[model samples]
Target: MDVALVTSLKDGMNLVRYELVACQDSKRGVLILREFAGAAQSLGAGAILVNPWNITEVSNAIGQALDMEPEKREKRHNHNFLHVTTHTAQEWAETFVRYETILSMKLLLLFLGLLSLINQFCGTSLPLLVASSDIILVY
Candidate 1:
């Protein structure tokens, strides 16, 4: 069904919420989300958080969402729109790779230190030298 109001009980990374917010760039829409939903933490500031089990609460939220002033709706939509546009999946993946690469390099350096001592004692050379510039993250 096509509607301006979007509600969800519980979801893991509710992409529908982002889709709704993205589509509502011209027309401000309302979103009522459950507190336990994964997207709530990110969009709760803009969405109306409610308990789905509470029918009265949910009903009241529906009314509030429908009857909300244009200025308020615009403000809420702006918040969510900004988040959705800036925090994209590619951006998140790139950030994860950057962080993990740094952590892995640190651990590798620690291991290499032990190898250095062994090489000195055994009068042997290790070809396991890695330069920071050698690893380039294109993304």
Candidate 2:
């Protein structure tokens, strides 16, 4: 988890530089966790590190992170911030949507938006397609 990374500087748990985070592949995945772990080790100097499995280890990691010198912590955080900003997309959040749900919602929103647009424009009737594939118009 990036709990420590999410904390603010001087918060004693700098999991990431905090300026940015790519996290494209996954926000929650083992590979993502491991990737974060690797980055924390090299960039944060194990200050924001955690095992996630062992409670004791997590606690110890937190204490170790909090006790690090401020200058060293700042330096490590800068590295994380730099890497996140330079190497990754500024905004790359991926979300899952069901195909059927997405299609239905998009169609509904487009239909509503077009309807509203037409209502705001010329005074005329517009054809509306129905579930039966039949065209219907309103006067």
Estimate, for each residue in 80-134, the C-alpha lDDT of model 2 and write its tens digit. Answer: 5555665543333222335667888998997897778667655655554334256
Which ranges of candidate 1 are over 4 A from the true structure?
1-14, 119-139
Shift in Å, residue 77, candidate 1: 0.8
The lDDT of each candidate is 0.77, 0.46
TM for every model, in the order presented, reads 0.74, 0.36
Question: How displaced is residue 25 in candidate 2, in Å?
Answer: 26
Per-residue lDDT, model 1, residue 55, is 85
* Poorest lDDT segment (10 consecutive residues) of candidate 1: 130-139
After superposing candidate 2, which stretches have Cα over 4 Å from the reference? 1-47, 90-139
